[model samples]
Target: MTSPSGAPGPGGPDPRRPSLAWLLLPGLGLLVLAAISVSLGAGDFSFSGLLAGTASESWTLLVASRVPRTLALLLAGMSLAVAGLIMQMLVRNRYVEPSTAGTTESATLGILCLMLLAPDTPVIGKMLAATAFAMAGTLLFLGILRRVPLRSPFLVPLIGLVLGGVVHAVTTFFAYRHDMLQSLYAWTTGDFSGVLRGRYELLWIGFGLACAAYLAADRYTVAGMGQQFTTNLGLNHRRLTLMGLLIVSAIASVVVVTAGNIPFLGLIVPNAVSLVLGDNMRRSVPWVALLGGSFVLACDVLGRLVHPPYEIPIGTVVGIVGSALFLLLILRRKGANA
Candidate 1:
């Protein structure tokens, strides 16, 4: 038998040591990117001056805008990735992710509703509404999964795509009718350009949710096993599943609200981490979170640097890069199954 963390059950490698890299490469990469994001912006600044902590308007821009943006990117990226990994594990499928599962779309709809209903609602109130509705959507999907027999692990992803499409259509309908299509566009095409000291506080929700995820890591792994098996081990599978869903919803909503929708982040980062680090949730969690944070920060940096006066949105870079990787995975799976 294998443990949920992808370890050999009884004779597995020592759980005390990380099964993968000597040093967490992904985390190291994230740190490097964070530094770069903090140092570079739309201003003319010397790299040496930044290192020396020189004081200037450019330095202030770097400090105020770029630094907070980098932090938000890291927090949102890590939370979403971890949430996606947990969703896949709980459902026993590799391709299940928050965006595909209709959770993000639902949250977006919630945001749109808030905008329409109470245009002056506080950001926290909007976030709470989004999270609540997003959690409901996740629970609905889980219920649907209970009724449907999964033909293959891959089939579940197809279902999610269809579900997301349906929700997107509904969201679009409301958005277009309310003459808020452009507003919704702004939400879908994520940009870190708006990140500043006061506005970026929403991202802290992701950080707090990540902490909750870490605390529940062991329980989620236990619940990943079949319900009966978990029951035999004296674990409450239902409670764990609900708890995982709550965490997922909170993280997903916060990411969507803060950074717009970043697809495949939840899927690709975790899959890559699992391939290298194995499935041990605890061991994989840190590296996975780091990889996600690093990947998004790098993409955000690319978006900023690639376009000088005008910046590309972070979601665009992620979509382009992540889609390519996702297609490769699909092709590889086809080859193996063929």
Candidate 2:
């Protein structure tokens, strides 16, 4: 149940929920990390130089590439984490995420369609197409849940995993037939090296979606409670469900378009925060956003530095970490149930 403040509180306010103090504490750490990230690669980047504005090359890298990349990380992190939270609430299951629930595959199909039909289309048009496919894909997953007898919570994600596999198969088949398989792989492989000024603007849509989520946080929690419950409380539950779908699909498409299948950011970030902070959507969204951004930013920096001058993809690092966490979560879940 929720506390008087509507935050999840079995007894009282969740201590793990960030206050201004908590925000400041991590905010400072993230700031320090972000500074380091911005200054690391191929430029005369230092605090003094940044402040004095003396280095033109440094300033250009800061403004054109590094700054945009960082912003993309922040937006992708925040949006995808919140998207995971929303999917969990909507399904009332902890395991569903854009990656798991066929959302990514659906969005990728949309992207593939755009590539075939209108390679010259603007990015926004591509985003719209992908968002539409993602919405349909997510809806299909939910439809599966509705039609089947799912007795175990674990079954929810298991089905989602299977669903994602099927979707991926389709994406692969079509991409191969079209002889665009290489382009497809590069597009969705989740690297940030290409995120210069002009390439990454689609991520702004994710930022805007994140803000919308914050505004309607309470509605999500209500919708999560189930259909009859929300309806009795005077909400159109279906409408809100569709709204959640739209938001989830929108952010997923935007992130995929701009950042390229940043695997497990959605799955790992929200689940990690939820373990500490509980399921208080209103209170927890900000924490999710902040910590998710910080985590992705750190991973991006690590990717850049691990090979130095050369680089690993941000998705590769996140995939390695997230896959470990995924196994751990499954084991912990089993132990708890046992």
Candidate 3:
């Protein structure tokens, strides 16, 4: 029932399942992009100068800023993509992700609340608050879905978007009242320009959560089959659902607190990967993480180069690209069903 590559195969081979040779290209691409990410920035960094023992400052800059920013990009991208996959499986909808499902908005709201209530809170405290709020918001979204009589796949993400919009409006209103709208914008928009050594280390926590998701991949795959089916298989559907929410919320909070929201990184990557690899989470996790990191790195590199010594936000770049891809996916699905 399964191929040597770990993909399901009843007849002979699943063409959608990629072989090791096919993976090499993207794996190499990720490495190249990471090298470029470390080498390219606002600051002048010349490898030739470093090799000649003349660019001490360039070396310092590489160590202090470039590496950390690149790491943050990879971590944020991987975490969000995996989180999105988990969400889609748990909700049984391809379109759902943290940004749409009120998770990111709730995390942003939590950060805003922290700034107001305890300005002196540490980074860990902010992460905790955001995670808690994100969990509650995701739960609310699920509760709403349960109450709805019709559960069209298209309707699910739309409901999530509406819920996210409401939470975002509340966050915006509070931020405006406190005269902290600018700060709020900085926290909500994805930008790597400000990332430094100490600031981005929290993203490692997200990386850990992503790994945990991999560990629970089988449970999630069964859960995706629906509650009654999962129950019949001797798994606790509600418990698995809660665990998935916890992982998703925690990853979203960490990314928001560290690199800000990279919208649609989660929504698009998992969907694209699922198209090729099917819903076997264990088989798909590495591909999802690699593609996610590569996409964000490409966006970030373009953001740096689009202007002269200035930068565009990664969020803007990803939003433009992601929206187009999202529309294409919807159209493609409609055609298939038609």
Give me the candidate number with maximum TM-score.
3
Residue 197, candidate 3: C-alpha displacement in angstroms: 0.6
Ranking by TM-score: 3, 2, 1
TM-score of each: 0.91, 0.92, 0.95
- Number of backbone-clashing residue pairs for each candidate, in the order shown: 2, 0, 0
Q: Candidate 1 or 3, higher lDDT?
A: 3
Q: List, residue by residue over 1-338, the lDDT tens digit for candidate 3.
A: 22222222224334466788888988999999999888887688987998999989998998899999999999999999999999988887788899989999999999999999999999999999999999999999999988986435678888899999999999999999999999889878988889998999999999999999999899898888778888999999999999999999999999999978889889899888877887788888988999999999999998888895888999999999999999998887777656
- A best-first ranking of the candidates according to their lDDT comes to 3, 2, 1
True lDDT of residue 290, candidate 1? 85
Residue 125 displacement (Å), model 2: 0.5
List candidate 2 stretches off by more than 4 Å: 1-20
What is candidate 1's lDDT per residue for 87-196, written digit by digit as tens? 97787676788877888888888899899999999889889889888888887777787788766656677777787788889989999898999988877777888888
**How well does model 2 score by local distance difference test?**
0.82
Tens digits of per-residue lDDT for model 2 on 104-196?
889999999999999999889989999999999999999998998877777887888899899888899999999999878875788888888
**Per-residue lDDT of 52 in model 1:** 75
Clashing pairs in 1: 5-279, 5-280
Which wins on TM-score, candidate 1 or candidate 3? 3
Candidate 1 residue-wise lDDT at 283: 68
Of candidates 2 and 1, the better by TM-score: 2
